[model samples]
Target chain A: MNYQSTELQHQLAARFVVGSMRGLARRRFQRLMMDIPKLRDEVAFWEEHLHELTDTIPIQQPSERVWQRIQSRLGWVQSKTETTSKWPWFFGAFASLLLIVNLVMLIPADPVIAPSIERVAVIQSSEARTLWLIEQREQRLEVAAVGAIERLPNEDYQLWMLPVDGTPPISLGLLPQQGDVILDLGTRIDLAQVAALAVSREPLGGSPEPVPTGPVLYTTDLIRM
Target chain B: MTTPQTLERDLQQIALGDTAAFRRVYEATSAKLYSVSLTIVRRTDWAEEALQDTFIKVWHRAGDYTVAKGSVMSWLISMVRYRSIDLLRNRANQELSTDDFDEIPATDTLDSSLDSLADSKQLRVCMDELQPTTRQAIQLAFVYGLSHQEVSDHLREALGSVKSWIRRGLESLKRCLQR
Candidate 1:
């Protein structure tokens, strides 16, 4: 009802996120999120802010059979298992290509166009322990996990370049769990303008979309090396 | 404990029709989300069905997930809870009362959820500041999926008073959280 008003929008959004706005009112709010940008933002704001309520409720792990049934429902078990086990070699070959490319990029006489080694970042845990070591050589970014690392079985840690201008963080690529991997540093990255480097935990194949789908786990200022 | 980023990444993959990522998402979130469903639907079989439906919807709607709405876990939990609520309503319409439902067992583990975010931590501190009854009312409405009338019945308060308490409590919570 009359969601056009700012106060009403916030109230409706809040109620929707908190799960009190039920049945038809909830459906209307969902429609509003799609049609109205302001209303969408308001709902997003409430979802982000009030999410702690659900988050703090104790975590309950579902039974293992649930996963088996889900896998069966999706028909992913047999074929997907084979697919994942075969991909590590591709990553290895990709890592080798980066070395050759780095060598070739440095050989060109055109000093002006050739990218240079500019900066490095060492992402550490909250306890001040280094987690990943990053170096930017020419246009290629390399990341290596340094300290004791615990990898989420089904997830990948993704690297991001944060801009100082307040734009959303840009994905650099997935970080290697065991060894260094060459990253596809997109052309849009400006070494001079980049404010920081951050890593987020993402799914195994990495984020399908451009934006980060997860929280920034580790962040470190880009220090010119 | 599943990180929000991991869930987000999986959701993104699932959106693009990655079945592997969908499985991973289910593995990471199903238990916690199932617990939420179980708490509401009060039957493991029904909760399991709700959990399955939730992920099916998640696979189809992964692209719709956005950080502005909340962390990936919150989004997943919301889907599960809503599905559980729908199942609960369906059963309620069929049965007069399910008062003999078994009680939820206390959690023994101290697993950190997506709520470990600074935003949630701050919200928790603020929530601790709310009056016990106000907090309970909000919890009943929110976590239990109880409506105003149901909350009034549980809290033994008038409908108008329950609505006002929850409304004002939420307003204060929003102010406190923003601060």
Candidate 2:
């Protein structure tokens, strides 16, 4: 198969743009495009020609925070932490004191944390099959999957906390498919203020972003125990 | 909907690192780009990530755009679609896969409007001429990013049959588009 063949170029470009070319072949095609400008032209031609297919897909508006994230990432906006505080240490100490008080009242619980648990969540399927059981134990979470989670071999399930503040969800680590597992609920959130807990299917090792980067599989309310 | 000319101007301003121009561009095109990303990725989280990455690229690689690239919408759509596809590949990577790959990636409905929006346009005219199954295979391939084998499984046809449909369908589309 000659890489320079015009017909092959056309077929590959069309398939690449139409999205049939993928995996190792897709990577190889991309590498070939660097050496062959004509391949790029073919891809661009296919892109332009087949682009009208997108007009058929309806518009789904992005959340406003995407713009905010872009602005922050581009250094167009000052990070909230970068703001000058008149009483930085005082506020920090006050926050630490509040955290200490909360921790003192609620000791960190282990797997048998039923009595000390403050909140709990159950991730289930539409069939009412319990997929995961979560217990909020002070600053840590105890997550247990009732049974095996039949997931893609390369995929994982991540727990996310939907904030009641209407901000973006905060990742709470990957969920286990079997047995009991404890998760750290980081100091950034208060259990009582959380709106809900969600499980999203992510690539293995979980999402790299500050938020989930996969389809939200199930959402359940955090129940106070 | 900002005019194409305005979009070009926004891209130029973005190249100059102007945030206001970037916002204007985001306001105008983010929805459409997000929609395309979601339609392909089928997840708001990943779609949002793709949209964010696309805009980040738009901000830094604004100089990449050219009038020859077609409209700004086309460029944006192409950019986000590729990003969304990358997410799919990262998760599935089933391009040449033949194993029982039953994962239908997208959840969005893909009922197209070509029949109503069909004009004398070359692409539309040619698309209408395709066999129903061939057109459907192509649509499933493009919209859901399904591979030949996956499309075969989706449409319940033989793998060889689906491959032939796509090969011939693309040929017809190329001949029509080129003309």
Best by DockQ: 2
Best by TM-score: 2
lDDT of residue B4 for candidate 2: 90
Candidate 1 chain B has its poorest 10 consecutive residues by lDDT at B104-113
Candidate 2 residue-wise lDDT, A17-111, digit = tens: 98888764665566577568899889888888787877777677898767765564444553343211111011112222332344345344422
Among all candidates shown, the one with the greatest lDDT: 2
Q: For model 1 chain A, give the 10-residue run with minimal summed lDDT.
A: A82-91
Error at A205, model 1, angstroms: 44
lDDT of 2 at B16: 90
Q: Can you write out model 2's per-residue Cα lDDT over B52-79, one digit (the tens) per residue? A: 8788768767877997777788889888
Docking outcome class, model 2: acceptable
What TM-score against the true fold does each predicted structure earn? 0.55, 0.60
lDDT for model 1 = 0.65
**What DockQ number belongs to candidate 2?**
0.25
- Which digits, one per residue and each the tens of the lDDT, describe model 1 over residues A151-174? 564577888888889788888877
